[model samples]
Structures are given as structure tokens and as C-alpha cells.
Target chain A: MSVSRFIAAAILATALILPHADAGEVAFSERRSGSTFMAPETQAMQSNDTANPGMLGVLDGATLWGKTIGAAEKSCASCHNDASTSMSGVAARYPAFDDTLKRPVDLEQRVNLCRVDHQRAPPLAYESRELLALTALIGRQSRGLPIAGGTDPRLTPFVDKGRATFMRRQGQLNLACTNCHDDNWYKRLAGSAITQAHPTGYPLYRLEWQGLGSLQRRLRNCMVGMRAQPYDADAPEMVELELYLMSRARGMPIETPAVRP
Target chain B: MLAVAAMLGLSRAALADALRPYAIVDDAIPLSLTGADGDPARGRAVVLLRQNTCLLCHSGPFPEQRFQGDLAPNLQGTGSRWSGGQLRLRMVDASRLNPATIMPSYYRIDGLQRVAEPLRGRPILSAEQIEDVVAYLATLRDQPGKHE
Candidate 1:
């Protein structure tokens, strides 16, 4: 028996003994044992009572709100009023097919278009904090709305394309998003557990980035992890992908600028 | 107590005794190195120090600390699933095994650098540190269930 074989046998035995081991149970046990891998001092800070600032971008967005731009003399307030009310549920139906453009358009593109045509403001750079802040503000209006997208017929092909992109295996791991997020979500990967890949709350503030970012940015990051060439921000493929993701999270309430670990 | 100890000894002996009979080490190291002999206490220190920043991508048993990353998988029970060697390989160079892994290799023996090295030719964690982490990981096993 080789050292590897011995280890394999031991693991097999452990697995057999713990046949019913679930990630949640494992995490729970680690917590209770007081033998947790994490430091005790840090544990107190992570307790449920800790209040995370929910949406930081909203603060930046409020400042930009109603700011005038464009040659035609228009501001965001020209069309949308008191964003908390009039803009409500607007983001839930985005990444729709633009009949004129003959492609999918996300909220970001729409905002840029509004800047280009309505406000005459220069289109904000992709992945810029300004764009993310604007998107966060816009998405906040749709907070609590169910994600409702892809009802139009023209969006069908794009949705399917996005779905294919998500399911296709890429990179050195030869893994699709479905592998971990869809199939092995309950399974362990190192010390952490996987969660369902829900996009309901996006344009979120991630603990990883310690800043606000859009769902498209998150998706591109995942693509980079997948070793796949990511589509440019607000690109047709990315918009289509967002549409697919939004459709998948149809009923989940939008947690705009969500906090994620 | 003696019987239980004897049983544990027998089990260890049986595992140790079986080595070399069915042992096989291919050019590509197998992914079965669980850090059975690793020391968790040492790993904890390594995590806190500049070596391996497992905390950078995960929120784990340590929440009091800030700057822990939330993107990658957590490292609570990493020892239970991965062998010491596997963990070492992952820490040294995750891209070699999983091309898409966002993890940076602590050791660059094979000259793989996903990002520029903060310390050239120095692993984030030493071999002994890897063992310590494996020890810490082993402690994560056997806990009561809790809500994630």
C-alpha cells in the first residue's frame, strides 16, 4: 500500500462513516466544536448582530442624482422623478431586446444611451465607479420587485444563447457554472460552501472587493476565473447573460447593492 | 481506554503497514493528500501572518477580523477533504491543478505566477506551515450543524 493509497482508503472510510455529511452540518459542527479553524476574536465580529452598511453606492448615487448634463439641457430628473417612487420596478425588466439596435441592452447601456441622447452627457466609462453608482441608484428603484424579464419574443434567441454560454464547460477545469453553482452547491469546496447562483441582488457591495460592483462585473470576474475571455461590460453577450440570470431569479426580491461574503 | 488506544494504534499501523504494498506515486502527484499529521495551531498562526492569506478570499470561523475576502471558498475543513500534499500543491500553485482557480500559489517552485510575486521564490507558507494548516483544518471536522 502506497502512502497515497493509505490516504485514499482513510478518506473512503471517513466518507463512508459520514455518508450523510452535508456542508451545512459540517460548518455547524466546526462552529460548535470551538475548534473552528477561524480565530475566536474574529468570530464575535461576524455574528448576526453585526450590521453591514447595506448599499454604499446609493450614497454616491444620491449625490449624482438630478445633476444636469448633455447639450439639450437635461438631467436624470427630467424623466425619472424622486427615484424611490417613479423608478420603482424599472430595473426588473431590463436586458431586453432593443428593436432599433437589434441587440440586447442592459440598464447600464440604457443609462449611457440616456446620457448620449437625453442628457447629452458623455457615456460613462465601463466598470467605472460612476457607472456602477448610477446603475446602483437605478437598480435601487427596482428593489423588492421580482426579476421580470425576457417576455418579448425577440429576446428568446439571446436568452438561449446566454443559457448556452452559462452551461458550456470552459477553461482548464472543464467546468461549467452549473457544475458548482447548480449541481454541487451543497457540496464542500475547501472550507466554504457553495450557494445557488442567484442574481436577484446585484450591483452589490461584495466583501471581497470591499466596494460596489455590478452583476456584469461579477459575471466577468467569474469568466476570468473560468479562463474564458469575458465580454466587455454592457456587451451584447453580457446583456444576454444578464437576461438569462435575471430570468432564472424571476421571483427572488431584488437585493440591490447586496452584501456578499 | 487501552482497548480504544490499541484500536487507534492498530488502525494507524494498518494504514502505515499497508504503505509501499499498494503505494503508487505517478509523475503527477495524486490529489489524495489529507493533512492527517498537520497541526491546526500552526496553521492558525500562518493565516494571521503574511504567509498564506486564506482569509483574503473567505469569511470563516474568524469574523472579528476585517479584510477577509468573500470570493473564494472558505478554508474551515480543508484538511478533511484534501491531503497535506494536495493542500500544499494548491497553496503552492492552484492553477496547475485547476486552471480557473483564483487562488495564488504560495510556493512557485514550478515558476507559475498568476500575479507578480511579492516575494520571489518564497512560498506564502512554508512546508511546515502547510502542515500546520492541515492540522488546523482537521479540527474543523465533527461539529454540530449550524445555519450558514
Candidate 2:
């Protein structure tokens, strides 16, 4: 017999004996942070503040916080007065309900809203270095704290919408966010480990991107990978998804300015 | 697991025409996709190809591979478990069997949304490639701990 035929025969006789699991939700006690899936060196990079490149954005943000900008000539420091004291644990509970908008707004959106309402400044562009720096600074204050988002009773509907989005199959690939992140966490996709979709790290540095980015950016990237139409940057669905992710990661410790491969 | 160049006597030029329509009979597609038997050797190569994204979600008897996904069932003994026709329908589109399946419909084009610009209007696999993979899967019939 030809080598291919022999191998084929061997494979056929031994199929379907492997065990498989039905799709379901991951339990809270079993939840894992994304860092657990990274290489030791990469994890070390995130653990060491000096070695972490995201800290550079935090330093820049510190400078911007005090330097007055915008028509109001007021800076983030003018009103908030020391992010360390006031903003501590703020990021951990974001994607919070907004009474004015009748919807939830993520940390980034809140920053933009502050700029619009108080600073009299035009909202910074998404993924802009300044926005990333500020968010990185704010997110860092919440590092080591447990995520507490999606707790607002008013946010129930938005959170539900976000969960639906995560579970729904979309795009040409016909996959849902839950398909890989939920069912295949700890599995390898090509060469990379598939981590659970948690929002523990935000304004985090990704080695592939070589810069800090928001959770929305990551969500859009996944949609593109699914061969699906990504939501617009300002879409409410983006905040909704972020809200749901924060809730899903309810008790996981925050790892702002995190480094990921 | 050496990669084999496809030699199914077919070409991209041969697939330029519209997708060949096939009727599903109950749970199977009982006709050759390219009107010819596919080469099992070439089909095996397609399964191992990284771009196909199969190994990302499945494990098989390929000992040389260091990382294999555990998302889906193991690919061993597929031939014994499923008929060639059923496997063909699956290769073309598994969602017909289970709507919530994470598997991509390799030979489907319509109803898919927001395909990347470069891949728009094209199925994930060609007719020949699908046939080749089906042929290769059908050869995976050796039972575990009871190899023939």
C-alpha cells in the first residue's frame, strides 16, 4: 500500500474516540486572566513597571493632566485634583450608566464627555496617543482592584445586548466571540494561545500592535478576523460590549498598561 | 506530514465559473464536487495547511505537530463515523447540521456578511480543495487502539 493510503487507513480506524465538551459558560471560580496565557518573558514585562512600555503613556498622561488645554484653559487636574486619590478604582467600575445619554459610557467615552462638557475641548480621536495616555494613566490607578462594571441596574438592558452580541454568530467565518474565547480558552489557534475574552487589561500594550489600545479596538480587530463588519468606533454597541466584558470579568484583578503578545 | 503540492489535475482557472450547484439529499451531498475523485495525498496537505485554520480548532493523529486545538472533536476515525457524502456536506457547510456550529462554511458564499475585501465573493475553499479534503478525511478510518 502507498504511504498515504496506510496513514489514511490508520486514521480512519481510530476516529471519534476523543472526548468532546458541549458549549457552556465559564464559571466565576474558574475564570482566568489573559496574562496567564502569555509567555513568561511577556508576563515579566507587564509585571515590571519600568520595563513596561505602556508606562511611557502614563508619564505623558501625567504631564497632560496638569497642562491646561482647550478653550476653557482648564486641565484634568484643575477639577479632579490628583488622580491618585480621586480616580483610584474609577476604571474598575466603568462602562457605567449615564443618566444624560440613557445608556452606558466606557472610561474612554467618559473622558471625551469630560472634554466636551467641562474643558470645552473637541473630543480626542479614538486610539490617539493622547487618549491612550490618559486612559492608561486612569486605568493604572485601578490596577490590582477587582473589576466592578455592569452593576448599575439601569445598565441591565445594555449588558444584555452586549451578551447577545458576544453569543451571536456573525461574518463570513460564522463564529461568535463565545466560540473561541469561551469554549476554546487555553487552546491554540495557529501558534497563539486563545485567551478568555476578559477586559482586565485596557489601554494595554499589545506586542503585535507595538502600542497601547482600548478594548473597543481589540473587539473591532476580532470582528475583522471573523470576516464581519466591525461596529463604528462610536457605536453604542461598542460600549455595550465593553460593559458586558467588564461584568464577565467581574472579580478579576485589573492589569492596566498590560503587555500582551 | 510533509506538504504535498496539489495535483488534482484542476486549476484556479477551472474554478472561475460560478459555484457549482449541488442538491442536499437528507443529510448528505452524494456527488463528486469536481466530477472526479480527489487525491487523498493532496487532501491531507490541505488539512495541514495553516491558512485553512483546521488545526487551530482540532487535533488529529499528526504526531509532528506540537500544538493542536481541543475546541472541536478529534479528527481521528472521521471516516468510520461519517459517510463520505455526509462529510462532503459538512465540508461545504456544517451549519446545515447545526446552526450554532463555529465551523466556517468552506464552499458557501451567499448570506455571509462583511467578508474582507480581498476574500469577498470567494468561498473559503475551491471545489477541488473541498473534494480533496473530503477524500482525505474519508481515509482517516483507523480506530484508536485498534489500528488496522
Best by lDDT: 2
Model 2: per-residue Cα lDDT over A1-261, one tens digit each: 333453455445334331122345666777888999898999999999999999999999899888898899999999999998888999999998888998999888899999999999999999999999999999999999999999889998999999988888777787888888887776777567888888898989999999998999999988988878888888888888899999999988999989988
For the predicted complex of model 1, DockQ is: 0.04
Supply the global lDDT for candidate 2.
0.83
The alpha-carbon deviation from the true structure for residue B21 of candidate 2, after best TM-score superposition, in angstroms, is: 2.0
TM-score of chain A of each: 0.78, 0.92
Candidate 1 structure quality by residue, lDDT tens digits, A141-203: 887787787777788898888888677665422346765555445444434445556676567
Instruction: Compute the lDDT of residue B70 as modeled in candidate 1.
Output: 51
> Global lDDT for candidate 1?
0.61
lDDT of 2 by residue, B46-97 (tens): 8888778788788887878777777667889998888888889888987776
The CAPRI classification for model 2 reads as acceptable
TM-score of each: 0.56, 0.84
